[model samples]
Target: MSDTYAGAPAKPGTVSARISPVGGLDVLSRNEVARLRGASGSGLHALLRRCALAVLTSGNISDDPRAILEQYPDFDIQVLQQDRGMKIELSNAPAQAFVDGQIIRGINELLVAVVRDIVYVSTQLEQVGFDLDASAALTQSVFEILRNARILKPQVDPNLVVCWGGHSISRQEYDYTKLVGYQLGLRGLDICTGCGPGAMKGPMKGATISHAKQRRRHNRYIGITEPGIIAAESPNPIVNHLVIMPDIEKRLEAFVRLGHGIIVFPGGVGTAEEILYLLGILLHPDNAGTPFPLIFTGPRQSAAYFEQIDRFLRLSLGDEVARHYQIIVDDPETVARTMIKGLEKVRHNRLDTKDAFFFNWALQIPLEFQLPFRPTHEAMRALQIHHERPRHELAADLRRAFSGIVAGNVKEEGVQAIEQHGPFVIDGDADIMRALDKLLQAFVEQHRMKLPGGTAYEPCYRVLNA
Candidate 1:
């Protein structure tokens, strides 16, 4: 509830403050406090520091994961247990996170979220020995994490729309996303996204105005992110509810299970990864009857972008995969109307199946999709991206390929590996590799690989015919 400025000489653009816990998290056990205080290489302190810095610098636009760390190297955070509750002590934190002399309220809640997730995952989940290796167990673990975050709303109907897009996009495309979001909000739908800048922030920005116009209250702008990509794409200021999953796999699962429908905008490898992940699961025979609304849309100027995505997808996953989603161009009203109709189908289907409205318990996600993929050089080369396999299986491996490229482009570990071992080599069927190479080239030429102000992007993975 209170914070003090550590009135001492500090790095420019950085300040020191000890702030009280916000609403998200307020108390921790003695052991939890000790573990958070631990600064060893294996302890939670380093992870806490990185995630905390990301939260403190919300709305930062940087594709380089290391940029924030390098900017404020001395920044640190600790969880201090006290008589009444717990307090968060921040050292050399970003000055922008504070206004006048107090920490920004929203940023404080997000910081508390960072602490809450790190502690829960380290102490509650891992220590309890959840068999994360098993598929069912893994899904259960994801549910537990969301439940612990209090993100699962049982009374609410199926209204959350997951918006997937890139942080680096043109002003035209960004404006288009906001337009779609505005239309969606006017229809009484909620917005969820990866929680970064650019397209992720656009829809939420648009929705706020429409919501206010309609006199709506308690609107949810949920942002779901993982540890590896948080620093690269910090949560935008519009994200009122932020949940950090343990890894990318869990993060993807949380999106599909929580949202009633999805809207994908123009993006690069990361967005492509999301598209393929959903397509792969939907293609599963067990989920063939499930009604999940998916739409791909953008401004008219970006038509070619979606065309390229469509071509690549049809080539890789076959023409039938196109049935799962529709592409709407330059029409936000139609996009919103289509999504509303789709949600009704989702609603009826859920009712008939006797499933929970908040979570999609009936969707069948296989073990392959649940497992976390560490995109190393050897693993990248081992992907089977040929058309000889089942459509869903092929989509799974293709998703992994895009995921690896995303890692090498932004994630710290993946970047380090690429620097030390060189760009990853992806070997697959000749035609598939050719299509992938062309798609990736388009992303680079369009500057979709990174934020606009950064240096030109270098390919982090090379595709070759096997």
Candidate 2:
């Protein structure tokens, strides 16, 4: 690894440096290092470069997948094996990730996490003792990934609250998320999110201050993400512990499995997708008695957002689905206090069920929620979004529909697919389609579909008449 720096023409914000691992990643097998150093065209190297660049350009706020690449077209990262250990060499990296020529410690740690998870998912987890087909095996794989990341604590109680919302949110909604987070932190709770800007970053930011004021130490601010979305929604600076799941399904699974409770704020299709996924799991007959806490909260102005979400869920799933969660508006302290009570029930439930506190081992995640969903044109069109099926099944398909919209809106492959093949066509039951169309239209009207200043929002999928 060379110490020589590489900078773009007239751009002093680029840097070059060689950095070693801090903690999470220390040694890699020869095969793994070779794979990481493979040619740019190779799948491994391309993924490594993209994820590494995402870490270097932390705090970047664009949702377009190609934004970072265009900004730092000459940037490059290489994994080098030394006699003692492993190191990463960066050229033309973002200057913001450095201080006086040394890479920031937190950024370096997250960079190591990027390399660690990507390598483990690609090389390991499949050789033996792992099966993606069986639901149990797939759940174990999720557990193993979090365990490998050292996120699953053996002694900790149920305090990690998973916060879900959009990266493109309004100022008031964002501030409300922070206030809720601050309240949670003052009560000695931790936070986890998607690791992006806006609502994702706000809670963690607020919690940091509250954690400090309360003299909390070693507080967990974990951020779980996947590779396809990381480039567009780069990890926020507040994410001290980061884990990149293999795909969206696994990422969603990780969230439910690890956190004690979930708090949702006003968001677009992506947030709606999360709500539907969890509700689908809860709707399963096997999970009827489970005591998982789920909350939808935001400022007074954002109450309409949750109302629209509640209407869509009821119209698509059922009124019975309302039993799974509660809605609290314009009250951060109550949100936090309510979560604390919910966490108590979760704690008692886990204890009575003989489950681990660090992970929700008893929740029955159906195979449908565990399977990977690729958002291709045919896959999108083939989704069974009718209400005739079981509620969970319908929720699963509905979740897929929103997931595809999310991919088209931000993910690189989905964007390219839209460019080449045109917008995806989604047709379903007449009533459900009408409800979905109305909800999606509201998202566009509220400016939740994309970042406010980006190009005029375009419908990525045409909701055909059912």
Candidate 3:
């Protein structure tokens, strides 16, 4: 969240610009703008611009942060107040966001989401007056933010399936994910994801067609992202609802809490982080009986990827961890049918336990999994990745290890950190470190670390096998 103004070019399109407010957001106070301007320099402002720009340019393919910034270098967004409502003032903004001099409706909606989330997180989430420390309070705050964003439908059924996977993936694997999504949609399930390309986009694209066929009027394609990763993988065109959490931890938590079940497609470090996070929660003894469906799936070509992931999980988290998820390959219909059966079981469990169907109220997420990880070099080096610890705690550390790699690979702060400090060093138990290193190397070989067109991704972290 650092602001880089020195030597950075100003918005290219113009010295000044004006735009009207539409849809959900329409107001901002002078006090808010002054605070925004004041806080913009302290690092948050640069983050705002990067995320705002990503939202404005929805289908941006380039994964490089500098390239995206350079493309819309002249774009600057300002908050303006009015008697009737509030309007955003864009100075030399991206011409793509405008159609015949008027903002495109979808882009405007996403822009409002950017402003709404940024302001809420900055003012409410970070405020000393708010009780952000208590775990229940933090969870409640997530609920409030989603409610304010109008994402949580109180009357909706337990059918929102959160799909977790990599942004960069193989073409056939992506098509398989789409087929699975189509089957799920035919069965009346909604889709949610990290909301980028590859596996994330596949399901939504597939479901859109089935949803149309089934006349499912309220098909939800929800996208949950954070500022750190949004620039690299901008919201895919299929995203109808986008909510940016304050960080990746909260975003992952939102997925588990809001979704009825989870589907894991082939992914790299980020996907591994997500898997470990979920398994850690479900592995907790208290949550042993909870019925939350988790599926690890891919096309036939992706079988090796899941096999490696499975072996790593069995070796590190214990074979007991296998109780948590099922792997289905080359069968989209079976994947959906398996998920549907799991959802039915989940519904019964919710009814029996008196928990809400829309959110997993009974899942116990420890503070270890809930807290934000800064993933500094020292932190990466200090992680205890081993077999002796409780499985859940090990999962937490493993999740953090992947989280650090994720930062190094994409996040702006991470890139800057890597630039300043060379490469991050990840040290761990010899066996676990070897497996982790091997999996990551495979990701690099398969081009899963970054988008296809960028310069070859240089290794950002070193593995130290102890």
Candidate 4:
């Protein structure tokens, strides 16, 4: 997409404004406001600045997080509490977030979401003393974050479809995502995604139109992201609800817990990481009968992409892994139908197990998958990707491997790490190593590893032979 904002040039510069909150983030305690105003040394200011810049530049596509920061170095935001309610003041903000000196309504709401999540995490979650070490406690943290965002609805049935894919995707593949999303929306399903551009934005864009056609009021376009990623992949403009989790692990857990099903589009290592994360959980023997629908899809021209993904899964995790998902090429209607059918099974399964329809409480996600994986060079090299380990364990390590690649690709800290220490070395089982090398090579060749129009991607990792 073009870096330029759509419509009239957006006044060509920054503007200062104080605006009242809309919707969920209208009220906050005095302590919360003070916490949000903490300086850079205290950690809240820097976090707030980066996330706020991302929101102001929504829809402008550039994978490099620092690029946006450099462009608008003077931009800043502050939460101002007044007698009326919560008010936000922006200084030297991006003009794109405003039209004719007034902030766009959608962007304002998302900006509020950024503040709400940051303050909630800093104050509520940390102060509550929730035991983060235990798996159940960690799961509860995810629930609490979602609940604080008003994401969990008690009366709603199983209808949320969590779409996972790369923020950088081909136009054809992006259109395919929209078609699938349109089909799902027509069927009354809601959309949730990583809240970025490209494939993440495509589905929500399509679903909005379908929802309008069906006269579906209060249709949801939920976007979930984390601090490490929000700068690079800002919440797309279509998102009606936004939530920021503490880390990628919690973010992934939130998606699985809140959604009824998952649909994956052609993407790079980030998408692969998500697929493995879900598969790892589903492969656990305890989750055998869980009816979570997963589909890998793209345009007909992208058939080879899904084929490569399928072969990799089979070769690494065995053919039994194939039972957990379907590869649907170029058939949006069938993908939607399949998801609809699978959701029926999911609804029945929830009823049978006496689990809540909104959250997948019964899904036994091992603590290993729930824990955060910091992809340092040493940590990346230490992963045991051999076949001797259980399939789920191997999948978790493989997911980490991909997660490292994703980090190096877009996240600011990961990029700095790579620049300082050179590429991360990943050595594992011979066969798995070879498969990984081939897969990454394919991603580079297909321009899936980075945004197509940006700088050429340098290898962030080296897969060593066993």
Instruction: Give all TM-scores, in the order shown.
Output: 0.98, 0.97, 0.94, 0.96
Off by over 4 Å in 1: 5-9, 39-41
Give lDDT tens digits, candidate 3, residues 195-219.
8888889999999999999988967
Per-residue error at 111 for model 3, in Å?
0.8
Question: How do these models rank on TM-score, best leading?
Answer: 1, 2, 4, 3
Q: How accurate is candidate 4 locally (lDDT)?
A: 0.89
lDDT tens digits, residue span 304-340, model 1 = 9999999999988889999999999999999999999
The TM-score leader among the candidates is 1
Residue-wise lDDT of candidate 2 within 205-248, one digit each (tens)? 99999999999999999999999999989999999999999899
Which residue pairs clash within candidate 3?
Answer: 11-74, 12-74
**Candidate 3 Cα misplacement greater than 4 A, ranges:** 1-17, 39-44
Q: On a 0 to 100 scale, what is the lDDT of residue 106 in model 1?
A: 91
Between candidates 2 and 3, the one scoring higher on lDDT is 2
Error of 3 at 122 (Å): 1.8
Query: Which candidate tops lDDT?
Result: 1
lDDT for model 3: 0.83
Which prediction has more favorable lDDT, 1 or 3?
Answer: 1
